[model samples]
Target: MSDPATSPERHPDAHLIQQAEVPPLDVDGVQAASVGTGVFAVATVIMAVGYDTLAAAGDGWWLGVGISGFGLGLISLVYTNDRRRRRRRGEKLSA
Candidate 1:
């Protein structure tokens, strides 16, 4: 006899699951990166303004953190924009 757990009768929805086809989602990475970069830029500005207060409060590193995040977000924005452009032109994206 077949194992009960492995038996076809064990799952009534197996056929439905096998026949289901999920469509791929179309996302705009450039837009997402732009939003992220904007947020980071705002944070960097806030941190810069509060640098003196933060240093006095022993949170001086927050300014650097904000700057780094803003920098990385900018990089991501550039990369995503390039990727979107390449995709639109039907170019093969580098892995």
Candidate 2:
């Protein structure tokens, strides 16, 4: 029987498998927010210009969908930013 740590064949490149500690970035969050804002702006325009056409469903269904999508995107953007901030501060990212 041979010791695993002393055998080169058992643990080759052990130093290369180490994990690095780094903070998360906000590029993705910013991009998501930009896209969300664009969607919201376009939806607002549609609602203003074609309210009558879109209100065919007794109400403005498309408007609601657009607004919801925009809201979700914004939420995602904010959540991502918060995660990045927490990561920078060495906080645990569980949620």
Candidate 3:
């Protein structure tokens, strides 16, 4: 077998880009966290704005909305931290 370093990167039998054709995005974790956080933030806003209307139906909506806001805030913090971590990781990798 030929050594990988001497071979062209593409796999000969690949119907599409093979697994070896690409490397993982090192910042994918941060990107995913940011996306999740954004979704949660939107949910928080929806709950906060409509909580009273929802609560009028006697469905414990206030508590649920409050929890949603708190959870979103917490996740936002985590997302921010992950971004910083990703930047640092990138720096390390590049260096």
Best by TM-score: 1
lDDT of 3 by residue, 1-95 (tens): 98764579857665553457677774436565566667666766777677787778875566565576568667766866766777767754333
Candidate 2's displacement at residue 54, Å, is 2.2
Instruction: Give, for candidate 2, the lowest lDDT window spanning 10 residues.
Output: 10-19
Residue range 39-95, candidate 2, lDDT tens digits: 786977778688897687577777777778778777777877777688788897674
> Of the pair 2 and 3, which is ahead by TM-score?
2
Candidate 3 wrongly placed segments (more than 4 Å): 1-20, 26-28, 58-95
Which of candidates 1 and 2 reaches a greater lDDT? 1
**Higher-scoring candidate on lDDT, 2 or 3:** 2
Instruction: Kindly indicate the candidate among 1 and 3 with the higher lDDT.
Output: 1
Error of 3 at 92 (Å): 12
Q: How well is each residue in 1-95 modelled by candidate 1, as lDDT tens digits?
A: 88766786788555434555877453548777887888989988988988899999999999888889889998988888888888998999877
Candidate 2 accuracy as TM-score: 0.53
Ranking by lDDT: 1, 2, 3
Query: What clash pairs does model 2 have?
Result: none
lDDT of 1 at 7: 85
TM-score for each candidate, following the candidate numbering: 0.72, 0.53, 0.44
Return model 1's CA RMSD, one decimal.
Answer: 4.6
